[model samples]
Structure formats: C-alpha cells, structure tokens
Target chain A: MTILRFDDWTDPVRPVKRDVIAKLPEDAGENPPVLFVPGPGHGATAFAEHWLPHAAGRGFAAYALTPRDGGKLREHVHDVVQTAASLPRQVVLVGHGEGALVVAHALGRYPARAAVLAAPVLDRWATMGTALRVNPLGAIPAVFGGRLRWSRRQLLSAGAPVEAYGRSSRLVTSRKPVPKPVGDPPALVIGSPDDRVVPRKSLDRTAARLGGAPLLFPGMGHDLMLDAAWTDPIEAILDWLTKELSAAS
Target chain B: MQDTPDIADRHDAICVIGAGAGGLVAIKNLREHGFAVDCYERETSVGGAWNWRHDRSPMYASTHLISSRPLTEFPDFPMPDDWPDYPHHTQVLSYLERYAEHFGLGAHIWFGTEVVSAVPVGDGRWDVTTRSTGGGAERVQRYAGLVVANGHNWDPAKPEIPGEFRGQVIHAAAYQDTAQLRNRKVLVIGGGNTGCDIAVEAAQQAATVWHSTRRGYWYAPKYLFGRPSDQVNDRLLRLRLPLPVRQWLYRRTVGLTVGDLTRFGLPAPDHKPYETHPIVNSQLPFYLAHGRITAVPDVTRFDGAAVELADGRRVEPDLVITATGYRARFEFLAPEILDTDADGRPDLHLHAFARKHPTLAVVGLLQGDAGVFPLAHWQSVAIARWLRLRTTDPVRAAAVQQKESTRPVGGWSRTKVVHTRRHWFEVDHVNYLRSVEGLLREMETSK
Candidate 1:
C-alpha cells in the first residue's frame, strides 16, 4: 500500500520524532547535526526516499523534519525553527527547491553550522519579472500576482515546482546576496543543465549568491536527487559536511 | 537425379517474404483476417529495413522515421507518450518487437529461411522454396496467397569511382560501428541520411571528415514549430490538386532549400533538385555547424591513398564510406513476373499487385519519403479481402482478374516519382486505407 519507503540511520527502531534532529554516522562523535528541511507538498517521507538513504549510505546521519498542522509556510518555518532550537550540537541546514528560500529566510534568524541549498527557488518577484518579458502580455499579471505567489510557498513544501512556478517565481524574486558567515560553514549547490522546469540560470544566480559552489550536469533533468549522477554532488555535500563537523569539533 | 525433391511437392497456403516492416504488417493483417499466413524472413528478426544488427542492413545511428509518431504508428497501437517526439532506431525496433508479440506473429515467422523461388501453381496458389542459412535441407511450402514484402533496399549500389584506392573502403551496410575510424581522416561518400550521420559520428572521433554529394538535397526537419511536419504535409496532400502543384507547395513549405543548408554551415552542391534521404533523422548538420564535419564534392577517382573529386580537388582519407542507395532485387521470381522499368522499381499496380502477376501483392516497395507502415497495413488489408473473395467466390475473382489484366502496364521511371513530395505519399496511404476499409465494409455488409 505504501508507494514509497526508505531506511533512515537515526532512531532505526523507534518512529521518527517531529522535533528532534538525527545525527549522521560521520557526525557520530563530534560532528555537527545537519537538518534536512522538506520542501512544500513533500514530507519526511520524500526526504527519506530521495535524500536519507543516499545520504546515510554516504555516512551522514541526516534528519528530515516532518510538516506541521495547517501546512502553511509560516507554520512549517516555525516547526523547523522550533526543531533547530533543541539540537545540542551546532546545526548545519540543508534545503532543496523552495525549502532553500525558507532556509535563507530562517538562517537570518537561526545561524547554522553550514547550508547546502540544492536547486533553490529564490525571489519570486525578480524571477517572474524577467519571464513576463518573453511571456504573452495577457497572461502576465495573473501569472505574476496570483500563481507565482501561491506556488513559491507550495514549491518550498513540495520537492518539485510547476513550470509556471519556475517562470513567475523567477520573475518576481531578486537573487539573495550571500551574508557574511556567522559560523564559517561552507555551502554547496548543485543543479542540472537539462532542467526545463527550473531554469539553470536561476541555479547559477543562487550559486553566485552563495559564493559559487555550483555543480552543473549536462543531460540530467529537473529532478537532481533522482538522477543517476546524484552521487557526485551528494558526496561533495558529505565531504563538506565532514570538514565542517571536524572544524566545529 | 537420385533423391532430389520435386518442386511440385511444396505445400502452398500463403507465402509472405522479408521480415521487415511491410512483411510483418502483411502477415499480421492476413492472420487477423482468418487466413493461415506463413511468413519467410531472410533475417533472424522482424523490423524490415528498420532492423539493426543485420549484417546486410545499411541502417545508421541517425536512422529514424520522418513521419510523426501518430502517423507512423500502427492504427491499433499508439506510441508511448514518454517516448521522444521522434523515436530513434532502438525505440522503433522495440516497438516492432512489441507489435509482433501482441499479434503472436513470431510463431508464424520463418527466420533464416530465404525464399529461393516462388512458382505459381495451376489453381491460384504459390509453391514457395526456401533455403536455410544453417545449411539444412531446402524446405518448400505451398500457399493460397503470396505477399512480397521483401522491401526495396536489398542491394547496395556504389558509384563508379575509377582506380583502386589503397585505403579502406566500406559500404554503409557493412559499417557496423565507429570504433576503427578514431583520429583517422574519413571520407563519407553520399549526401543521404546515412552519409550525413556517418560524417557527423566520424567527425566526433576522427581527425576530419569530408562529406560528398553528387547533387544538392532539400533537408526537411522532422518537426516544424514543435510538431511533426508530416502531420501538416499529410493534410495538405489530401486536398485534390495536381501532382506537380502539390509537390511545389510541399517543397516550398517543408523542404529546406540550398540556402537553408548554407545557413546551417553546410556547403550547397552545384547540382540542382537533389535527392533526399528516404530515412529522415540525422544529426550531421548540427555537428557540422560546430565544425565537427566538412563537406566536399563528389568523388571522380581514387589514386592509391588520395582521392580526386570531379571538381578537381584531391584529399587523402584513411577510410571511405559509400552511403549510396540500394536496389531491390527479387532473384527468386521469374524475370517476367519481376519486371522493372527504366527507374528500376518493379512495375506494379498502385504499388500493391504486380502488373505481370495479379496473384502476387508487393507491399513496402513504393516509398515516397513517407513512413511505409500505414501503406503496408492498408495493402495487406486489401490483399486479404481480395484473397477472401477468391476463396469464397471463384467466379468474382476470375472476373476481377480479367478486368485488371486488360489494363495496360505502366512504365517505370525514377524521374516521374522523384519529384513527388512526402505528403503526396501520405495521401496515397490514406486513400489506400480508405479503399481497403470500404472493400472490407462492403464484404461485411453483403455477408
């Protein structure tokens, strides 16, 4: 009956806790706890299937936080913030798609050890503003004001965003400039060239904002986590995580 | 004549030759029509000219159907939506395998059995003699109907290039893969799809590549504005217009002119109104634009390692590929029944029944730049119905045969059929389907 299921290293016997962070194998003795925040329309299940099994295989005890009630962006953000507040070790945050933007907003409040933003959905206004130039005039306003606004929060929760979400969200949002490091944690960003749904240009801008840790693949589609070549980027994230966790220790 | 088997001992029911696209369609159609059809395929697999891995096949990496997925697909089976807009050779082969499996066609398929001779018996039946490549004893079979779906491309025709070159020379059919041509200067002779594809692939690994075409060809894209161009062309050809006028309009719309090739960084040949490749897909020009491939004039002579072009240019190439077209050879049939005119295609009636032999139906022979599956499907249906009538009512069969025999045989001329647009062929396919459908409907209604 269950369409998707994956193995998680943290708390193998008990059901996953909503607030507690899980420690990766590499983070066992003195490693930093890395929290994997789920995107809009997704849950801890997706993170388990897409990220945890692979990440745990690479020796990282990654924690995927569950979604909260009402399932709004504000509530989920509060959930993530509440979960991060209790972690004893210095936390390294990892967000995918729109969850990257939420991490960006949340990082301004709760400083993490390091951030890994995979295919981030940045500013909606600047993103859609650019798309409206090529898009037909009649569909511009509604596409920008109504669809783009609602989809960004949805995409942040869901691992994948609609095509309109990529176009309009890109038009309205400007690139978020990388802030001065409060904790000197290195951020790694990865994307695919063949991603039609999420323009590689947006990933480039996102990488530039994070001081250029971009890893681009040619034939891979929009779903980077599902790609066969995901191991390279995921390994890079673990390597960065290991170095950071060591330095923190 | 110790123990030689007499040809008369062969059993006859239905003999379908060539396991390519057309042959499979004919077999499937006849079986569906409740006829005990036995298909004789020279090759080990079904997929006609579209099949790869056959030693005699000239199919290349870029070989694909020019027809859109919708039109190219069998009426009963639609292509998968997840498949690319223009399916590749592997995809096409997989689809054919699926089609064969769905229709239970393999049990009837006689792989490695080459039809050596097909002689007509006295009572509207055929005596078919087959030889297995395994050196086994010859097997002869008799059938009530005979369908020649052997297809057009059986013999590779190489251009007459004077003097023997010391370098390696191979026909497109013999080209297995591109492993040997790495870092070597390659000369790909012929401007058709195979030549272009070879030139492109060779350019990627080879030091350099020179593509030679005797004449300029109009390169038609598989898609126009994100849709298959054949879809638009098919609609246009169905409008009752003079053949020449229709061809002209088709050329203007879908066909890429010489200037268009220049824009894509390919050299336009000096010759006018060139021939296009029958199989449509090739990524050569795309690679050419990126400086991976170079175009040259036609070859006149080969002097040891160097080759001299008709345009007075000379270049040395380590390997030469002849992408020259193929000739359809039916050696098994009698010379009278296997009649060919000036253009070399067997003289047939509307490309279905042979003019000299009304009892014999030839599917997949008449190609006009369009996909042959639909045409072959319709032809099979018509042939099946005709056979059904022949069995049910001998009097009507005789009358129809008498009427058809009175009609004058048409002359074969390549020049006449060459100017025909792809869309014109689609119109023929549609018309053939409708005619066959109408005949089947009439037969059903009367019953």
Candidate 2:
C-alpha cells in the first residue's frame, strides 16, 4: 500500500521497511514476494533475520515491515492489507505473534496465494491470562495500569526474548476483531509446545477456527524463529505449503 | 546440491537453455518455487551478452551500458553506488557473477554445455539433446518443460544492395578491436547505435571516417540535469503525462541540450523521437561538428573501392563496416518447431509461450530502449508462474489461458515482432512496464 504514517509516540518501536538482508530472486512469472509481519514486541528483523536467508535460499523473495509508533490494532491490520495489495503478484503472507493477527485480518480484505501464521495472538485477553500465569508479579502493572513495564527477568520467565520484548508497546488497549476460518487460498498453522507467551493450546484453537491442522514443534520456545530448532517449524511450514500450493494449482 | 544430473532423479524438472541473465533469473525463480532446474550455458560462465568474448557476446571492447546503472540492474540485487553511471562490460559481468554466487546459483548451472536440440516428447515433456563444450559425448535427457533464453544477438544480418564492393567489408559484430582501423579510411553503414559508436570510434584512429544512414535519428545526451538521461525519464514517468505530451517534452529537452545535427551534415530525424529507441551518444555530435567524422546519406550501391550515396555523392574508402544489426536465430531448433512470421521471428504468445507446443517457451526475445535486464526478468517470471499454474491450478490456468495472446499489445513491443529491417522486437520501455504490470495483475486476480 501507500506510505502509512503513524504518530511516533504511539508506536515507540518506529517500524522501518529497510532493505532485505539477503539477495532476492527476480521472477516475473511466478507468485508474488513473501511479505512477512512480525509478532507483538518484535521488529521486522526479529522474524525476518531468522528466516529471510532461508527463504531466499529456497528461491522465494521474502520482505518484511516494522510497524511505526503507536496506532490502534485496526490501523496495523489496514497497513498489512494495503502492503499485500501493492505487490505485483498474489503475495504469500507469513506473519508471527501479533503479526500473525495482522495476517489473519488481512486475508478476506486482500486475497493471498497462501498464508502462514506462527504463534498468532488470536485472543489478546486469553494471551493476558497466559502472561499472568507465567509472571504474576509483572502481570499486575500491565492489567491495572496502561503499561507492560516488566523487567527482562519477568519477560524471560514469561517465555519472551529480550530483543522482541523491548520493542513491544508498554500498553495493550486495542480490541481486535476475530477472523473467520481461512478456506480460499488455505493456510498453514505452526506453533511450539514450549510457547508460553501465546500458549500451545491457543494455537490449536486458532488452527481449528481457521479450518487447518496445527503443525506443532515440541520443546521449542515462543521465539520459534530465533530458537536453534526454528528449522523444524520453518521446514514444516515450507513442506506443507509446497504440497498444498501444488495440489490447489 | 543442484549437481544431481540424472533426469530420472527429478521426474518433473525444468530445463532452461542459456545461463545468461535471462536464464539465471528463470533458474533461480523456478528453484524458489520448488521446481528442480538445470541451466545450460554454452560459455564457461553466465552474463549473457554482457560477458566479453563469450561465444555469443556481441559486446565490443568499448561497449558500455546504454542504460544507466540504476535502470539496468535488478532492484533487489543492485549495483554498487561506487559504480559509474554507465558501467563497462567487465563491471556488468562481475555484478552478474556476484548475483549468481550470492543466490547460490552455481550448482544450478552447468557451465560449458550446449543444448543441441529440444523436441517436445508429449504431454508437456521435452527430449533435450545436449553436448559438453569439451570433448565429452552428447547425451539426451527428458525434462518437464523448456525455457529458451539463448538471446538474440549472435547471428549478424548482412543486407545486399545492387552493386558489389570488393573492398575489405566487415560486420560491426566482428569489429571487436579497433587496431585494424589505424591509418585506413573507414566507411560505417547503418544509423543504429552500433553504427554511430563505431563511426565516432573510427574518427579517432582511421584516416577518414564516414557514417552512412538510411534514417535520421534523434540523438540524446547521456545525461540531463546531472543525472543519467534514462533515470530522468524514470522520474518523469511518475507524472503520468499523456504519450504525446511526454514525447513532446522529451523532444524539447533534446533540442535544448543537443542542437540540430543538420548543421554537422547529418539529416534531420524523419520520425518522432519516441517512434524508435533513443540513440544515446555524447561523442557523435562533437565528432561530427569538429570535422573528425562526416555523416552521409543511405548507401544506394557499392563499387570496387567506391560507394555511391542516394544523394548522388560517392565515397571511396579502404574499409566498409556494416553495422546492420542481428537476426533472431534459433540454430538448434527445427524450422517447424515454433510458428514464425515472414520476418523469421517467433510468433509466441506474450513473446514467450508457444501454445501449440505447450511445453516450449522463450525469454529475452523482446527488446526495449530501457534496461533489458529487468524486462528479461519479468519475462522469466511469466514463464515460470505459467508453468506452475498449468499443473497446480487449472481453474486459474483456465482464466490465464483466456488472456493468452500472440499479439505485441500487452507485451513490451513497439512495432510488431515481424516488422521489416532492424528493430522487430523493440519496445517502448514505459509502456512495456505498464503492460507487464497489467498482465501480472490479471494473473493475480484470477487466483
């Protein structure tokens, strides 16, 4: 989409769409580039740096966008939809965490060839419940007040990496609309049993609601992309998507 | 990992002919989509025409990019900023090599290999005959599909006039070095960029230099307002002005910067500046005015040691160089394989797909005044995606099939592909880009 501007104060993270980390292939004949959206508190590099080289290694032109300073959840969704719409070919939307929520919201508005949602925050309130159980001491300030001012120890205990946690908004006030099951281009749902931030069971609910099977990796952290065993889930998504795309075509 | 060469190992592998820029893009894109690909290059390496001294490279020693670096290079794999506005052939070759290595395209390519023939076996499969450039034996293999990116600059076209000249005659393609021109009077025939470049070059070394033209060309300066001329035009495209207005504006700028050629003995341009590709040269105008080079009329006939002009003038020179241009040659393919017009150029759909022989296709067959690298890339994209849709999504393929065309309308073509004389596959760069965008949009919406 067009350049979307947000008040820098709102999104203190200052999302920037920098040059991709790896060399991309030139394809006028195939599907569009992969537009990746990072999960909550994570920047474009958080998810992209982990898998962009791999995506390029596989022959796909993968790119990402870091959301700018503060805006409502709807604004973030709008930006993602517009970005996908702007591509030359039908884009493949791969989003993680809150970024996954953006991809889910983007589907009906903007048609994609396929979608991949990794540890999506489907229901924020339920996500808050998981946040409390993981670190109850830090949960009080986040719920009562408009701040998620948790220490690094609290975030680590809650299964979040310092890199992603640092960029996340200190407050969560937006109510996102639930997405219907994806059936048009189909979708690949991936998660890890050790994902304590969004919780592994939430991934099952999301997969069921989206009418797709859950691709789960056991003993992996919420930062599945950064974890050493990230390939397990990345390859799973890559494998399922290849077959699903070929079968559909 | 791409070294697996047994066709039986990959039942659905795509075979790409030529490992040049066009074929490189095709190979990489196909692999990215999960299709196994094998790229065959007759040369020891890639870069296509940009590679100097390659078996098929038409590049002269002084050959620099006609388009600027920003316009010519791929967007994702960009040339370094330190590079000149227009880089030499060596720089371009290095850039392409870096692209191949950066994308790990080495394994995908088979260096020093030639495709002897490719015949459609049946049901979207091809029986390809290839031979190693070394003393190795020939071998035949099966592939799911074939993409012909052999390029169109190999064979030189030599036109015949009424009288025959017994002097030292040569085609511009063969004039790789200028050492032979020293102390000799040279006459370069043709009005295209090659003719102009050599005429200007011969002016420096040859005793006397005369450039003959059948047409009048609008000469454009290499730069405008301190930026590459094409880059300035790229910025102008954002305004989205009407075609006539854009042409008029460009003509005015050219007139303001590079004055009338008639004063220097060159005839005024017969066609509008936009009618044909812009001949960008900074030295031609300077050399003509300074008396280093003389511009002459069309060569009506030739005599031993003498050349007669249409204007009733005659010139006797030691050498006659014909920069007449090249013809589209598919030396490896049989005549009946793909349909061609009277001009001998293939009449493939979108300048790519051959519907009758569904398993066959071609890339880099079309030309635009702008950067052809990007154009080749887009053509490769169309071919690769179409192959995927042909098998994966028939409903979408049906929709795409509806848009399948043999016309140059939606393609980046200026005149028809069958037009007479030089420039059969020329394209209006901006119009071509828009047309490609439309095609891509139509395909995306179909799914």
Candidate 3:
C-alpha cells in the first residue's frame, strides 16, 4: 500500500508531516502519489498554492518536487525516478511546460501507472527555438553547461532537424529518440487554447502520437493547474487513477 | 456669404472615420507616407474590439482569437513569450494600445468625438461634422481625403422570431459576461464563433445548454499538431489555384466540412448559406465533444419557457443568447458619400477606394480568413501612397483608378465566397499581407 509522508531534502528544512497517509485504503492500495512537476519560474510552492489545497480536500496525496537550481536535467530526472521506483506502489507523473519534457524523459527509463502532461515541451529543439523564447543555440550551453555534454548525433537523434542547424556542426546535432515504454500507459494531455507560446496544434499532435490518449482542451492561459478550468479534468484524472489502482489491488 | 460660420469653417484634409483596428492602421500608414491626417473615434480607448470590456462586453467568456499569435501580432511587435498561446481580450487590447503608443498615434486621435456627417465637397474634399460624447459643443472638420475604418459589429442583428418567449433574450453583441447565466438553462442561438463560445461558457455555469446553429460547420481548433492551424490555413489560401479549387482544397486540409459538427455532437444548422462570420476559434468544439453542451436546430417559435425549432423539436430554456451576428452601421456617416451593398456593408472598389466617391476610401471592410489588422495596415499604406500620387500627379491617379475600375469589387464576393467560418490563420495572414504589399509596391513604382 502507498503511504504519504513528508521527507525534507535540505538539512535546514523543517520536518513537518501535517497530513500523512499511514496506508492507502485496501481498494486504493496500488495507487501512487500524484507528483506535480511545475513550469519555469515556478516550483512546489506554486503547486501548493494553486492546486494542492483543493486536491488534498478531494482525498489526493499530492506532492510537488522541490525546485533545484543549476542541476543537470538527467540527474534531476534520475533522482525523481529513483524515488518513485522505490515506492511500494505505482505512481502517476503530472508535469507542466518544461517539466513535461523532463517527465517524458524519465518515463522513457521508468514507466508509470499513467501520465498527465499539461503544456509539455516534447520537442525540445523546436520548443527551445520557438516556445521557450530562448536562443536555440544558447540553450545548448545553458542546459548542458557542466558535466552533461550532448554530441551532435545525440541531438539529431532527439528530433532536432540536423540540416537546419548545420550539417557540419557536431555539437548541434539531435539526441537519439528516447526508447518507448514496453506497454504504453494511458496518458491524459491538457493544453490551453490560448497558449501563445506552444502552438495549440502541438497539443493535439502530442495526443494523437500517444495513440488516442484522452485530451482536455481548455480555453485558458498557459498555466493549466492554476487555472479554474482545470478543476474538472484534474478530478477526473485522480478518479481514474484511484479506480485503476483499486482494480489492480 | 453673409459671414456664415459654415463657410468660415473650411478645413485642409479629408477625415478618416472610426479609430478601431482598421482606422488605427490606416492612420499610421497615412502618417508614414507623410499625409496630413486626423482620425476620429467614438470609443474612449484605442483597441476597437479589444478595448471593449469582457463583462457586459460582447467579447466575454471563452473567446480566444483564431489567429496565431505570430500572425495576429502587429508588424514589428511580437507578442510577449509568457502570454498564453491564444491571447485573451485584455492582452489583445494591451497589444493594440502598445501599437498606438509605439507609433505616437494618440495625438492624431480625437476620442469620444463621433463623426456625425461626411458630405462630399465638389472639389475633392469632404465636409465633416462631429459631436463630442461628453455633450461639449459640436465641431466641424474637413480634409483632402477620407478613409472609413469605422468597422463592423457595433450593431447587433436581432433575429425576427414569430413569438415572444418568456425567457430573457439577449443578443450576443450586448452580452457582457456569463455571471448572469449561473445555474440557469441557456439556449445559445447561431453557429458562429460567438454563439459557440457563449454556449461553452453557459454549459460551465447553467444547469444545461442547448446550442442552436443555422447550419453545420467545420471548426478548426486554434492549433493543429502543436502549431497554429491558422498558419496552415493561411498558407493554403495563398496557393495559385482558382478560387473554387482553393475552397475545395481548404475544406480538405482543415478537416470536415458542413454537416460535420455532428461528430462533435453539435446540431447541423438549417439556414440558407449566407455570409459566414469569419474566425470562429477552436474551443467550442471541444466543449461540445465533452457533452457539456448539446446542439439543436434554428428557433422557429418561442413558447414562454420553451423554444420550438425549425425541425419541430421543442426545448425549454431560462436564458436565450442570440449569437446571430451583427451588421455594419454607418448611420452617422452622411448618406450621400456612404454607399452600401444589400447586406449593409459599404461598397468600395478594392476595399480602399469607394465606388461612389474617389476621395473617400474604406479600410477594414474586407474580412476573410485572414486577420484585419495587417490587411488594414497595408491597405492604409496603399491608400496613403495613392493619395500622395493623386496630389502630385493627378493624371497618374486618374489612370490608375481607371485601370482598377475593370477589376471586380473586393477580394471575396457573396456568391463566389467560400466561408470556412474558421478563425484567421497565419498562412492567410502572410498571403494577404504580401498581396497588399505587392499592390502598394506596384502603385509606388507606377508613380
């Protein structure tokens, strides 16, 4: 059975367990904690303010990953995936914006019960150039500044159009496609109709590529979890997770 | 002349009317071409449709622009990266306000001053009359040339129903917000974007919602494959194919034509194919797909709490919203200079020069699958160039007008027009801009 408890990563952090779940109900024993991945300039605090209070009221053991600065993307993903793997029960991953891309990478390594991708940047190369407003070339140095290094072949394999960047340039090539999960999990994709940064068409394309995963298109701003329109869809996702976990149990 | 005030009040240039999307762009173009220009606006703020508030404003609840942010953005001003993909009304307004501020357009604009009349003077000029909304003294101004950018949507088209329904009936034009619709059953009439959005908002609040469409329509969402479908549609519209062929190709690429709304559980419309409202954003179809909204046929009669459809089905509703569309009202403009088509739109040749008068031009009257801002801006530039050439070389201006006289009026005709009834796409926007640019460039070279 899944248990909910607060564990501090930082030494100075307070050890508070305000709402701990000792054990999941027998019916929901196989269910996992809903891990929220936030967007840029946001962290767990934002999730707590916008979604967690209401989610907690609805019987969800919601948890947000604390934001880390100057960390390698793969390392962070590995840490989160490792923690989720050690859990007694399966877990569902929910991510927004750049966090969505991170979750997808992590999912490639470790599959989850299900995933809810809200405004995720699946095509990192295209997204870096267009959606995120960062210089595509500049993003390379910033994201892989330290220990992490991406070769041109790796970048080319990861869906970056090699010819557009330059055929001769070795460092600018795409990364290899992340390996697909053995048995694909059902995914729920949510996006804003008014999301100016991500092309609205991308949301549908992402859903279609996922083999007819259910989609929740809301006429809202880019921030899905914070928007009032998300209430119904989030509830639906949690309920679906609960039912699936209970059935497995 | 007995020292009359009317004779003493003669002015130098012609008046440009209505400082909305069309007017602002036109004025900027004229100023760029070094033409002495003055623009008059009825609204207190700049951003025409954008300036109109959300609550109690016709543009409230579930309204996202069909145009891509890139294409919808004004020239030289990209939309902020942090904004949502489809910008809200407030964002659009702020963008427009910024456009005006960036161009120093405020000084040229006379706000709260309604143009009462524009009588053509015999010598290539117009006698203009204006009344301030604050009840100040009426003012008269005249100019060398006039451009009408007043735009459409100020007047609401109320459908002529046979009987009075007991339910509260509201026109989509006057609809401010959805707060009044909470917990009530709503019947939203019309299949246009406004009607679809109203239905979506109503479904979120009301106990139930019944959307009435006069005909079936294919709705392309704001995006496709994570890119703006508008961009795709815009590109398709610009191909060198014939008009009919282009229409057919457009239907195929956009996915599903009329009578296809049933797949989404939306009712097929029953009305004759008239002019379709351009640019219905994609949000409404998703709402229908979720079963939050139900679709029905046209309203034939109203029976207090119940409404009878043309299909002979009846349903009761607490609130009825007629998203039936709007008419272009230029009653304030003098009848002599303002000539209109059967549908009440001003008849202009090439959407810049009026068929009735040469000195007076009309911008923003042309509405297609493309956005009006870029088109209006470009047309204004053309008009300004044409005006400059006319003053410097009258012979050349006359010859150009004679050449254009043989061409058909406007881009899309009522009969030949293929109404996608979808929002503006980037491809269409680029093509239209290019076309206008080409036209202006040609005019410049001719001079």
Q: What is the interface RMSD of each candidate, in Å?
A: 27.6, 13.3, 25.5
Tens digits of per-residue lDDT for model 1 on B72-131? Answer: 655334355345656888888987876676455788888988987888775667788788
- Residue B39, candidate 3: alpha-carbon lDDT: 86
Model 2 whole-model lDDT (C-alpha atoms): 0.72
Model 1 complex DockQ against the native: 0.01
Per-model fnat list: 0.00, 0.00, 0.00
Which has the better lDDT: candidate 1, or candidate 3?
1
Stretches of candidate 1 above 4 Å error? A1-249, B1-12, B238-259, B262-291, B341-344, B398-445
- In lDDT terms, how accurate is model 3? 0.60
Per-residue lDDT tens digits of candidate 1, residues A1-249? 000001101101121236333535643554556688756534565566556766766665678775553344434544555455445544678876666766665565354668888766664544455434434352366463443332232122233333313223212232445333322346777766555435667888788877784777666544455444555556767887787657644
Ranking by lDDT: 2, 1, 3
Compared with the real two-chain complex, what DockQ does model 2 have? 0.05
Candidate 2 off by > 4 Å: A1-249, B1-10, B134-137, B161-166, B406-412, B416-419, B445-447
Query: Which candidate tops DockQ?
Result: 2
Best by lDDT: 2
On the 0 to 100 scale, the lDDT of residue A210 in model 2 is: 75
Given candidate 1, what's the lDDT at residue B357?
Answer: 58
